[model samples]
Target: MNIREGKKEYLDMQIPEELHQRMNDVIKLDRKRRNERKVICMIKRTMASAAACLVIFAAGLNTSAAFAETAAGLPVIGGLARVLTVRSYHASEGDINLDMEVPAIENTSGDAAFTEAVNQEIEKIVNDYTAQAEQEFTAYKEAFFATGGTEEEWNGRQMDILVDYEVKYQKDPVLSLELTAAKGWVAASEERHYYNLDVASGRELTLSDVLGDDWKNIANEEIDRQIKERIAADPSASFFGYGDNELTEAKFTSVSEDTEFYLNAEGDVVIVFPKYEIAPGYMGILEFTIQD
Candidate 1:
């Protein structure tokens, strides 16, 4: 599970020592599943990008022989004029449940084919992830009973799966979308995907586009300053290795071209960090808004 912002704060788990130790095994298994999911998503995205290129190229060569028209209409990357919850799943089966809102991009402006490809990929991801989560929950439940967990103790062990999205920015040609997936029972983990669409241009937006060539230095300095300011504002919140905080295996460094980011409504570039990426999991997901 990936932690995210603007979600329910994780509750302090009051698990019994014996049960906690047993659940640790389940948690470890879930970690494995998460890793596998990541690999699958990376491959899916690669395939989607390749497919998009082919689709666009085919359209350009066969449909629009006019180079100027093709270049102007078909974005180099897939984009959307609007986003809507095209599908949803909400059901409960005893202690198991599914709650998701599948988002799809609709580009009436032009290039519906690439947008369709992206939607198909998103749908596949949600379906695959949901199937895996169902299997994991069933296994965990069976194991609990096998390991002598009582009925009363297992009463509230529900697998509430959730998937949702938000539009971070939507101003004419530039649109930013954020998708979040997480398990309600496992608030300690989360996953997020950000999409920045530029209808005016074919290329994806980068930090250099927004912050010029000195993006890394500017971003690093801003993040460091914000981290300190946030910690000062809330004494309980802490980012790993920023000050007197204990060193962790992963620490905040400079932003890269591949770093996760989005454009907010204010047109500010918001840099996003996954939970535990640069801070303790308890802090949830960290975000730094770079303002001029």
Candidate 2:
């Protein structure tokens, strides 16, 4: 097809605005992370280059990285992991804002059970959070009126409600994904959940698998060492117990067996902590890379 025909067809296609924006985000992300590589229109297959993948697969993509990349690039599919936005719901009602995306994985390396479980959990999370958000907003508005707050004072006020997911790591059959639900109306309520899967085995990736049987001790020692080093290097550098902190109980402790984490491009295990989990909220989310 010529450029004009392609342009006309694109114009004629019916695409949801939210889906379009999401696809744009994916493209931009790909462009940033990936160096110059021949991005072709045709579908192709590429093997996992890392040694870890060999151990896992020869020992997941039951969908390979090449297939995922090619499929994601296509205008219709539009995201990583062949993770299509099966549900995109948005609302702009006054002071009651809602934005959500429910993704469905296609041709996953994980078995049918794994895929089904992931999808059900994600859908439930999104649905439950959305319902809670709406309730919270309604309750807040009622309380405001009862407390003598005028309509004019609350007329222009608004709060965001969002439920979304992102694939943090997707190498062949091993995928690290996260789901997040947040509201800004009051108390900054936000919750995040992570899924690190060995898609081939249909089993969740554990710290033990990533860092061996002594994963907890290794992670704790390395984290504390890193924190102390940072504090020693710069006094101003603040981490909960290492530096200035108001919350005495929020100190960096040994990583839990089910701690949220992901694999970096180099196949290194990067531990993740949500905001205010181990430090103040100003520090936002924190990550620690387990050194070899």
Candidate 3:
């Protein structure tokens, strides 16, 4: 099937409950193979001739000389791996960029060069897998169209494909893989309000009141919970201190994987709290320099 770029479509027309489950399953599988050195190399090669240029542009390389050159003797390896993981979220495209070094594979002869070759081959697998995912989704959508459904009928759903991968044979000699999938649906606003209760005990709002105070309060509460969880779990303790300092509220003006927030009591802007890591590494938190 001739696949065209910019053709917005999904894997199915109706988005059945079962299909959502299947889509999520496929997505998990894709993510498992997402950012191996093979995928990184493919992205780097397709975007530019010099790894440095691509690093500066796609990966967001910093002005540091260590980042400006190859890590070890390999192009786009170590530091690149960290950058890819940090910004990509297993996404094929995004605005966030990496500004760091890409470590080289030390030495070129024998096993080392062979290991690099293996890494490049893995990159080919990622590119091919990504292309195949697009093709599969397009083919499925086209087939669905042949059944006489209008494009408008297929408008609400999306096929969100993702991939994740790791190098088992970083020093060479082995190949192993772990893959999973997740298929899901985006809920309609009506469906969302289906079970929601109004704060004042009135009927749930229609389309007009969808973004009213009730929804905002719910959303805000969710955000606060997430931020507090991050601060409590961060290894760096970069944001909230680990002990019994209660956080009645958190004002988050900016949020990402590395989030920034202001706690209720101290009224200070704390930075770079990894939501999941905040609680686990309190000892390490004391070791790092945390700025208020």
Candidate 4:
């Protein structure tokens, strides 16, 4: 896909109507499965990104299978070009169900050692989440039975955990990956992990890599200003401790190189705060775009 002026042109060509319809069907199927399983939250952003890749590949298949396969094998701009589901886990009992998609990287172009390091990191993250989910589910099951809840009742209580990843930015030399893990019953809790890499050197990029030495001061100031502006503009806008509290001060003033962030489609730096990290769970995931 060719991205021009912040818009993806999908190779600057038209996709056939039949292929477009098939892509739509795939998206619809994904939604249906999510609904049927009653997963807490949907990773819409990552799903959309995945859908686009599928569409692009599907369009290529229409021309020639060989060409399509070649294009699919092409390396992404910076390093990792292909994101595929390496593993999936699913379990459904009376009231509980768990589903997860583990993403893996392929066709990486970089120093062999560095590329392996990045891949290993991705695998470790996914495995950690999978382990946690399994542990939680097992505990829940034990507790349900101990509380006199019948097996049928246990089967009826529904919970879901999903994992997905998106290519946030893929410009030359810099590549950003956004990994999402979302879970919930009535409401969902979501967390995002960002990996920014300098492909040439096989080094992970921190906030300081993108911003300069004064990054802390600049980022904290911008975040504080935006937070105050949001609260002023809308009374409903709320954070954990906004007024006069050390907690609020600590949260707002502690911007560091390790802060979680990624470049959006518009190439804006976006700072992410997991649910309840800075505000109520109802606020979902909190994000602020650092103005350039």
- In terms of lDDT, the poorest run of 10 residues in model 1 is 36-45
Highest lDDT: which candidate? 1
lDDT of each prediction vs. the true structure? 0.65, 0.62, 0.33, 0.59
After the best TM-score superposition of candidate 2, give how far the Cα of residue 247 lies from its true spot, in angstroms.
5.8
Better TM-score candidate (1, 3): 1
Instruction: Quote each prediction's TM-score.
Output: 0.66, 0.67, 0.27, 0.65
- Alpha-carbon error at 52 in model 1, in Å? 20
Stretches of candidate 4 off by over 4 Å are: 1-72, 75-80, 88-100, 185-189, 240-251
Writing each residue's lDDT as its tens digit, candidate 2 over 1-292 gives: 5677688778889887899899999877644333211100111112332233344333232346765454545343222235667788898777778777666655333254765676787778778877887788889888999999998987767767766666554544344445556666544554656666544345566888778999989999998998788778967667887666656677888899767776665667778887777876656567789977
| Models ranked on TM-score | 2, 1, 4, 3
Q: Which whole-number lDDT from 0 to 100 does residue 75 have in model 1?
A: 38
lDDT of 1 by residue, 11-89 (tens): 5545578997789988887654443211111111123444554455555555554643434453333322457788887
In model 4, where is the ten-residue run with the lowest total lDDT? Answer: 37-46
lDDT-sorted candidate list, best first: 1, 2, 4, 3
lDDT of 1 at 167: 61
* Backbone clash pairs in model 3 (N, Cα, C under 3 Å; residues 3+ apart or in different chains), count: 44
Alpha carbon RMSD to native, model 4: 18.2
Which one is best on TM-score? 2
Which is the winner by TM-score between candidate 1 and candidate 4? 1
Badly placed stretches (over 4 Å) of model 1 are 1-80, 186-188, 199-203
